[model samples]
Target: MVFNRKHIENLILVTVLTTFSGQIYLSPTGGTFRLSMAVAVLTVALIHFRKLPVMLVCGTVAVTIPLFRSVVDYFSVLDADFGDIFRSYLPVVSFYISYGFLFLLLSIREKLSHPLSFILSLWLCDSFSNILEFSLRQLISPANIVSDVLIQIILMGLARSVLTYFLYNTTLYYIERYDRSYQENRYREMIMFISSLKSELFFLQKSIVDIENTMKDSYDLYRHLESGPQKEQVLSIAKNIHEIKKDYYRVASGLEKVLSAEEDRSSLSSREIFDLIRENYQKLSTNRQLHIHFEFHCRTPFVTAEYYPLISVLNNLIINAVEAIQQYGRIVVEGRLEGSIYRFSVTDNGQGIRPEDLELLFIPGYSTKYDTVTGRMSTGIGLCHAQEIVENHFGGNIHAESDPELGRTTFCVMIPFDRLQEVFIP
Candidate 1:
């Protein structure tokens, strides 16, 4: 709209393109008067880029087309000079210049919303401009006019007007479709992003609950040792726990505020949840194991409001499977609804859990992972946290089965449909 350097460059492009369209013309009865797709090209250009000066484009085309054709014509005849026979194409110059101004005077661009009015106005401009060309040609050559030629000219204008309208509509249709696809993909990404944030909020709330319980136990200890030598130490421990509880409360409050806007999002689909999970761990897998591949399946459509704990539980199991594998492995996650319960299983072809340690898998501070480089023990609470969320939040059960002979471990979780999906069932 500013008529900057970009607009000047675009104007030059429209000028060259319109002149090229005019060059591809056909003479009806072996005369200099020509019919071409120049009008259609011009109309489309004006419709698409409203900031391009319409008059400047059309007037420039009028000069460039004849000048280019005259030079070509002059070269065709070796005896002709620069000025010879260029006047014969003068009618075309009048034709396009008149077409440009008549287009503006008729308000063709503004009436486009009314299809019939726009086409009628367009037909008027093209037909009248051609008629002016024919009259000028008659004055220059003293030729006779036929009635059939006039009708053909008018119908050609109508045909080109209708064609231009379709061209514009088809272009608009594709643009709308592309915009719709882009918006749907962005919406999916947003839902997954909110799901991750909600998972973190669930952990913060659980930490606050644990801190509160610990503070109560510490105070009870101080009361029991009221007259003992360690009585003040017990009270000091209670006070320190009290301060930690307040910090946890501040963190929980901040996380709650961040999730406030997304609270209205009632549920999420099972397949979408798994897709997000697959995308997350697959990236982590590629960094450690080049040949690690993942596959996920959902037998029935499921939607649940308990997706925060759900994501946390699945992320723990999959990460455990990923870390258990040394270099190359396959991890498959499958979910299904059976009767009144939903079940999910994560199977991995990794180093299997030991037979004697199977019963100890859910115990807090119990793990088999040891980091040789750092000489440190794994925090060993991942499976315990996962179990707590499953059993406490969703009233579910989780367990593992090992086929040590074949080196595989599968952890399965079962939750009631009524508990996980009462708010949104799908």
Candidate 2:
């Protein structure tokens, strides 16, 4: 085994239960410990493992400690007869039967997964086994059974069950904290990589713009040339220049998006930020010939945030909404103040998401868009990057909901106002 958390937990339970085996004797006869402690540890182990065969093997190994003690004592006192030896084995047999019965009860009933049910099952099983042992020795009477064996078993089982329940919850708490820290570190690394890429694209975009202007001037000079042998050569050169210009325009357009994403928006208000995004998308809508209505609703005129990331998040969501539509759709971007939180949403009447695919939508390298003929697809990091920025940097939340049949999807982002204030004020 690779020794993951589950394996480590199993090892701890087995070691602890076996070490405490001879510590708390509850019987007058020579049983060396309170069986309830081992039972409680076994119950916790069963909850973790859930597999019956694994639990049975672990329980068997744990019981061997106490059983060995009983065997050594019996042989040391040689005056003991066959009857005495048989009596010495009674507690071990009862302990095994109790754990087996409790396991069977839990396995059969789905509702018995609750701690209360597990504790009740433990009490009943332990009490029954003890009663059987006492009855065989003719030590059980109606009054004595109620006051002595039954009450003691119930109290012991209850204490151990409660202790084990708290321990299990504590273990889960630490595991979650560790996972959250690891994810935050990954987000920081991604942010650094994106910053470096944007810097390179910005310089490249500037150089392409200069080249495009020079090409435009050359074409204008060629148009002015007289009709002659030199004129024909100049015209051919102009044609080639025009084609190269077109290629540069396409490259520059993509670079613009990458450059715009990292713009310093630290000083922009919420309304100003939305207006900038609206202006950019308006051109996109006109170019694509898509009749998409865009609307922005902001209750608060201004809210402070790291402007670039806020812009990037809203831009990605709006673009995703626009691309989802086939020909025509309505996109509504809304912002408001809900107490100490800034809430923003993008709702689009486009091709909606499937229920099963909704959860995977924000995972990196996972996309719903695919072009079968050309074998081309989206990089699938837009939403994932947006989520990392909102949650990790701003301590916020982002989620989406969709109705596939109605072709409507809505993405919502919530950032704490105090969190934004911390970034902008300092």
Candidate with best TM-score: 1
Q: Which pairs clash in the backbone of model 2? A: none
> Residue-wise lDDT of candidate 1 within 1-426, one digit each (tens)?
467998888888887887788777767646768878888888888877788777888888888888888888888878886675678887888888898899889977788799999898889999999989988887777555556668878998898889878877887788889999787667656655665565566666778889889989988988887577698888888899999989988987887787676566677788778887887787788776547789999886778777767887888899899888888899999998898888989999999998899999989789898776897888777788788778877898999999888989999999888887744435
Top-lDDT candidate index:
1
For model 2, the stretches where C-alpha displacement exceeds 4 angstroms are 1-33, 51-94, 107-118, 129-151, 170-426
User: Which 10-residue window of candidate 1 scores lowest in summed lDDT?
Assistant: 191-200
TM-score of every prediction relative to native: 0.64, 0.39
- Local accuracy by lDDT, each model: 0.82, 0.66
Clash count (model 1, backbone only): 0
lDDT of 2: 0.66
User: What is model 1's C-alpha RMSD?
Assistant: 6.6
